[model samples]
Target: MHIDLIRTSSKSLPHQISETLSQRISSGLLQQGVRLPSVRSLATALRVSQVTVSKAYDVLEKRGLIYCRQGKGCFVADPEHTRRQEDGRWQDVYDDYLPRAQLWRNFDYSEVKYPFHIAAIHSELLPLKNIGDSFASLVTQQPELMATYGNFQGDLELRGIMRDHLKTRGIALASSDVMITSGTQQGIDLVARTFVGPGDTVYLEAPSYTGAIDVFAGRGAEMIFVPTDSEGMRVDILTRMCDQRPPKLIYTIPTFQNPSGVTMSIAKRQRLLELARSYRCLIVEDDPFSDLYFHAPPPPTIKSMDSEGHVVYMKSFSKVIAPGCRIACVAAGGNILSRLIAAKSASDLGSPLLTQRAVLPFIAGKYETYAAQLRVTLRGRMEKAAKLLKLYAPPGVKYILPEGGLNLWLELPASPDIGKLHELAEQESISFLPGDVCYSAETPSRHIRLCYSQMNETDMEEGLRLFLRLLGRFLQMGS
Candidate 1:
């Protein structure tokens, strides 16, 4: 029997061999009951030490990819054996995971829960009672809205309310410039479709929001990820990129960004806007987390600062208000906005009229008292989570103290295998996002992100303690 020894780098020999062998066995290239070569012979042939070959076999046995008939040798396990062992593995993973993926994929939101939820970000602080009241009043007062299709530009009154409310944040735009979408995910897709055709390039943060990246990827655009530091997107690198191959659009969160919790400095914002103009690229500024800030007032959005009108700004009410409400709005230049609205007409007819109507009263200060109360409620939860993180995190795990936003990025101890941690965390019924998942091609292995916005202090503490416990166990395993 001929077997190809896949070449592996010196550092990853064991893992590479195991992965290669696993694929071979799974594909039925290695038949059941087939005796594999002795570890000593394979090791000498592959120019690796005996230990490396032994480790590969050990892992394959552990994963049930192969079995050792003691004193005989390693042989391929029965294909049925592996299949039976995984009888419901994919289903379990999907039942547990598909909700989050669907939520990210713009699936129906009627039963959606924010993935990795902690329960505090939702029911505790949202003005659900006020929202429910407005929603009922709208449906009762104008039952025709329910019977008829909503306007393509969304509810006129709600757009007017948004136009007026945005003045406080330094964005002055007419209702015509606003096109309400199902959520920011749709807004991003609209922008991607409007400007970026197949093979076009778009620049964004290295470890940026995955949902946005998925949208661009689906549209077949080439993504160029620029690194970000505490101060935010590396403008110098962006400048060089623009000088080389100017991308079709520049996507960013100038305010408190997700995952990293790093807010872009005002100077970087200015440079970014300047770069967009000089390069003549559209800037998709996603500001979903801007309103969640725990610190001083954020700098005005890049769109607000744009004089040439190269920026199309998107904002979501899901994180700050109520996700189930499913409201997001985009403000762009007159030209871009017009094109986006035309596309919106084709995508879903229009945003839900009642949902838009329900948001108007809340934005118009009709529910100011409760809104203020909710802000205080979220701030308290954030502080409590921070305190617990400071208490329980193991040494070498680093994180930025966020001003706003639901999550914090943790740089962990021991360059532990994140896939293993994900498996371990899954076993314990606790979930977290591995750092590599957030990144675009270049994976940063020494990190993970946790969202405190969904959980209360007690749950945050409990979840973190569980994470630390797993980390300790992983370290003990010498991985």
Candidate 2:
């Protein structure tokens, strides 16, 4: 706990001490509930007066970094919990872009040996040959199409291709019902903008996808959290809540849900559709990783079960096929489809014509072969990673094993400092998505999301072993 301080600097002794301590606490170097050295002890160790230490501790206490326990000692406090107590809570973690981007972007990939925070297939695994060849063929065949602004409702032929793609997943929507967007996030953004407004209620699962959270919250929607389980979003709870306070729209990632990797039961999905119908609300089903299943396929999508236009189905291909293309499709009928198309046109006119044209042929022909091979590779990585963590993780640390999806969701034993864990992992060139950012409510979260497909087998094994050791040490510190 030794801090280097300048004796002759312009900064006051208390300022220097408080600054150092605050940085440590905020960065999670000193995790929540860990006892801090007493005023006298720290003063003596740093060769400072007791009054100076007291002033520094006072500053920290004001910032909700530490709390004094009369007879016991001073301990690190959870800032999020303190904020909640003061009614100064962040309604949504991704209310701002900087905070959201800071959490997920600008990583030094070269230095990071194991970037488990990344939620896409490894570059080596992407269908590079198929993509390049398809793009080249499309560009050569239709040089003028590349210069054109493509359809706002997405390419008709591509929509037809996507319609067939959805058929493989048990969803049967007409090509005319589909609209293309840059990616699934944009699809969600369009939905939020088209329908949701300030103070409008939107129901999303607890610990849901951060991107969707950002979109809905950015639109000023009053986010209501629906708790989830092994079978995914608790439909019973949703049903109970709907009678009390009905949301304008419901957002759900039913299959291989982001961060949690859980799938909603078929019964639950059907019930959800029924509930939404009864309430006269909308359901936005964001289906990202449903196709990445390990063994048995997940239940038919909510959109598939809906005979009426109650569900809006969105799917992304960027994560698995080719990230740079940023291709995704949304299927909605009637005025809802018209509104999204209008929103999409206002946003960017349309997605790149080249990408739409390029992906259509590849998706029509080679995508199944590519996805089949990818599922096998991803499953192997997932199984081995799961085995390693289950064997070595500290007691009380639990995880959900998914039938499909790239992420491995972790539940830590006690609340270990996630900020501190991130800082420590950075030093080891490892990364994982801290579960705090995934929440709509800013609460103390003891969870993490690790993507197994981010690295090769060698890096995955070595990095996960190192990550486990870090967890063991962190838990031991809590003890």
Model 2: per-residue Cα lDDT at residue 50: 96
lDDT of 1 by residue, 177-229 (tens): 88788889889988887788655778889777867776665554557789899
Predicted model with the maximum lDDT: 2
After superposing candidate 2, which stretches have Cα over 4 Å from the reference? 1-110
On residues 1-479, what C-alpha lDDT tens digit does candidate 2 reach at each position?
Answer: 56655565345778767865664454344557666788988898779999999999898888678898788778778754332232432332112222122222324355787888878788888987888998888778879987798889988999999999898778888888998889898898899989997557789998788788767755656677899999999999988887777879999999998989999999999999999889888999999998899998889999999888999999998767888899999999998899889988999988899888888877888888988888999999998998898778878888878899998899997668887888888898888888866765536678998888888888888899899898888888878
Best prediction by TM-score = 2
Global lDDT of each model?
0.71, 0.82
The true-versus-predicted C-alpha distance at residue 6 of model 1, in Å, is 27
Instruction: Give, for candidate 2, the lowest lDDT window spanning 10 residues.
Output: 92-101
How displaced is residue 262 in candidate 1, in Å? Answer: 0.6
Model 2 residue pairs with clashes: none
lDDT of 2 at 138: 76
